[model samples]
Target: MSAKPSGSETEIVDGGSVRRDHTDRFDLRALYETSQLLSSSLELEFVLNNLLLTAMSKLLSTKGVALLFDPLGSAYRVAASKGIAALPTGTDIVLDGIDTNDPMLEDDVPERLLEHGVKLVFPVAFGHREIGLIGLGPKFTKQPFEERELEFMASLVNMSSAAVHNSLMVEELKLANRDLDGKVQQLNTLFDLSQEFNATVDRKRLVKLLTFALMGQMMVTKHVFMIRSVTGEGDNGSNMHIVTAKGVRKEDLDADTIASMCAQQDMVLFVEDGDSEACDHLREKGFRLVLPIRQKGDTGAVLCLGPKMTGQTYQPDEIEFLYALGNLAFVSLTNSYLVEEQIEKERLEEEMRLAREIQERLQPRELPVMQTIDAASLALPSRHVAGDYFDAVRLDDDRMLYAIADVTGKGVPASLLMS
Candidate 1:
């Protein structure tokens, strides 16, 4: 069961009986009801809507608007409104002198609000700072606001400010949570790719694996991957080469573009919307960001990412993941190069061993056992396959001919040339 609310009260003062006035008692009930309704929910829009409606009803006004100050943006935005020209919620109004936290009449209101038929402005405040404004138009009766009415509106704003602040806090927290969820997803993808990178040794296949990972997880549609040469060729300075391309072509990206975009190898570059020639050129190519990979204090590789299919800019952690992926791919490719080099070195060493053996055989064995003047000779190869040879032949009746030679080079070529 519910009992009807009463506005009657009694007080014994000065040894006499006195009764509380109905208007004062009624105002108390209204304030209590307004506070209860405002506190019922933390939804910002709901709270602001109810607040605007209550202010309109109390003032008997035809138009009203709820404006919340955005400290970060340094402006006020329309949170809710009634009977006014349609200004969408969150539309910014950059009015100055609004932070005075004082009630404003028609003459005191800004010209902008005056155009919207706002006749009164009440500041919504908590502690020392005013967070918002409640603007009311003229009453339906066409009469000016009374002194008590102004007082009541101030009281209503004071009561509702706490609820609005709480709602704003909750909304900000939800946004933060959303950003964190994205970060976790990206890191998990990186973890899986790291394992795959370890197993991949072929450069072409490694690049394919990385490209697929970006397309699947990051919603990347257009991308290019370029890696600088590690061999240190002085004549060419060893510029980076395009290893993979999706929507972009190898010829479209010149050497200067890659070098300029990757100037800051330690950090990612976010393409800003601008009129500069470089920026316009990148935008024309559909590239949105550039991620550089560092090796020995130099730009070793770069991953040029185009816009996502969803048209969302890359988040901070997403950029971090791409940079890490580029580095991982580079490490795997470097290892592949080293493995191939080792195999080649071993093959050449085996060829050298065979050449040395042949060279020894071709060398004069025992020098034909010369019996002239007790002649003797020995030819032992050093650690290398040198082009060394020695021989002596008797040229008819005590005339002797001898030949000895050592090639300038070593290894298989020298041994073959000497033979």
Candidate 2:
């Protein structure tokens, strides 16, 4: 027969089994809510904050902190916190992987967290590596965390770690794309300048265009342009003359300073130490960079620039391109000067030939003969047209007069004066 309970006795019951069923249902609901909240955003900081808040709520803890690992520095930094005032953000700690499942069971929790009253440490792991840690104070109910609750916390972190890592990767890709776009823009600017430089030959206009292009590209306001001073018959010279200047006193760029800069074959920065007096003068004039324009192993020109208006230092690639463009402009200016010289020489030579022809025509082809007495004349010409002349005049009876004269100067002017 089945046993029946007596009125004073209570029937046996499995209270532990009933409690386990209730706890399982509660844990499932909490996990579902945590997943939904964390997966709603791709922003790392937002995800971290939400994760900490959810963990604290589920565990009934008063304090919580999230520390994310920075692989570059090989350390973990506090990324998010709640309810703990003294746990400042961005605090670094070095904690390796642990075999113990519960942080409270570990022998060595970092003192930074221990001193802040952190009682539990949970690893947020992804793909066999720990990416961060979650620390929490004691539960509000003063109840010890069960095995099921710790396991559920680990599952929650695992799900969120993947999302965090993916967000970081996306951010890196965006930065790389921006850098590439900047490079392409620089290349296009250089190509346009090259086309303009090819079509330009006027010295003044060329310098103006070059200056404008450099100022616009580099974002600089102060500049000085120096080109070699060509005199006499040849295109080469060692003297450098400043062609244009702005944002600095022109007199400050003295002769000796320019000469010293023109002697250098490479770009130089005017710093505080180990520089010559000329460089010091440049610094005083607010010039930060000096770039040489070399022709045939000698500096034919130089470009001086002040600090960038954008407050950024010039990169190596930018300096290299400026050097190349400066040299190109120098060559074009030199060619224009040579062409002008040749044109002037040709024009002078043509005028000299015309003057000689007019002088020859003005003289009598043959001297008139006088019957009473014999008269003779001879003419000799020099390589250059000198305004020397000889003429004969006769009066009817038996008298002849011979005259000679020389005019000052040479070529056309002298010939016209003589005439």
Candidate 3:
């Protein structure tokens, strides 16, 4: 028998002889380069494809390669492959544990490998987690794999596993960022719409604007505003009047019934799909939401909405938006009422001023310098412009005409007619 080679030498055992030669450093360099390439990229698809291509070109010395990932419960998705005749994209393969000794290999194997002259199957895993498997066809030189080649293939599989793990983490981070961005955009839109609503004072126009703003911002199908009159007789009685409504039939709503129910229940908000008994009747009536419009501790009105245009149920965010919109409507209504009242007060004051002018002219100026038994007369008007008149005129031959008259009211009409 031939003597065994030293530690630093390569030994070949053929027949009954042993030959020792220097080890080839090229294979070691190839392995290091492959590891560097695999570690550099964290993108899942890029890393996976590079790993397969590098292994086939440098480590395994194969003409073709294939990478498969068994998402376990999901499909057996193909990541990358080379050297096969038009390798299927997103192909599923059944793997079996008996088919290969690779630790990352699955229990069900693809049957095509048997017919296609596959030389090796490598399982790639991160710790105990089986990320995927690799398959390689025979080398172009048609040479059998030596022990050294098998060892290098094993190292490549380890590098591939780490790359796959990093890629998956990156993908998960990207998805999370996208979700967060969507939420932030929604919040920004809500804030802007709220600001616009707060600046208006016309009740009818405000209600219409609010409904349209909410629908556009939140992408809802329809919104309705049902404003109940504040002044009405009886506490428990049906006094709810539909002052304004949109996106629904005014005739279809029973305003008195809704008002009475709201008054009895003492509920300010009624979400039709939420867990509340107050919303039961509203839900049956095809309304998806009912938001109360409150002003200074009194429930003055209700704003309702149907389902969203997306046909999805309302989320907590959507409910909050509706509440804000309802509050804005109440503020606008109150402001409009105050403006109307002030205008009416100013109008009445103007009329009183005009009446005073007419009354002052109606009285005789300087009392005609009369000398009928030394008579004199004076008239004084009240703050409300009363129509009290006094007159004295000297007639021919020392005869005098004197008269005093009072009209009922104290305005332009009474003053003009008094003349």
lDDT of 1 at 168: 75
Comparing 2 and 3 by TM-score, which wins? 2
Instruction: State the displacement of the C-alpha of residue 106, model 2, in Å, after optimal TM-score superposition.
Output: 14
What TM-score fits each model?
0.78, 0.56, 0.49
lDDT of 3 at 204: 63
Q: Write the per-residue lDDT of candidate 2 for residues 1-419, one digit (tens) a residue.
A: 12335443434446433211234323566677777777777777888888898778767788999987777887888888888888678877776554334455334566667778787887776776656788888789888777776776777777777776675566668878876786677678777777777787777787777778678777777888778777522122336666677786666676666765666544555444327776776777777888887667766788888888887887776787777777777777777777888888899888778867777777766766888778676555563466778887776567777788888776556766888
RMSD of each: 6.7, 9.0, 11.4
Off by over 4 Å in 3: 1-187, 198-205, 227-243, 260-281, 371-383, 396-400, 408-419
Worst 10 residues of 3 by lDDT: 99-108
Q: Residues 1-419, candidate 1: write the lDDT tens digits.
A: 22333535333344454444335522867988988998999898898999898888877889899998888888889989888866667689988865456899989998788988999998887787667888999999898988888888888888888988888778889889988887787777778888888877888788889888789778998998777765653112336767788988777776556555556533667667444565566777888887778877878777888989998878777777888888888788778778888988899888778877776777556654445656677766665587677777877666677888888876557666888
Task: Report lDDT (CA) for all predictions.
Answer: 0.77, 0.72, 0.64
Would you give me the overall lDDT of model 1? Answer: 0.77
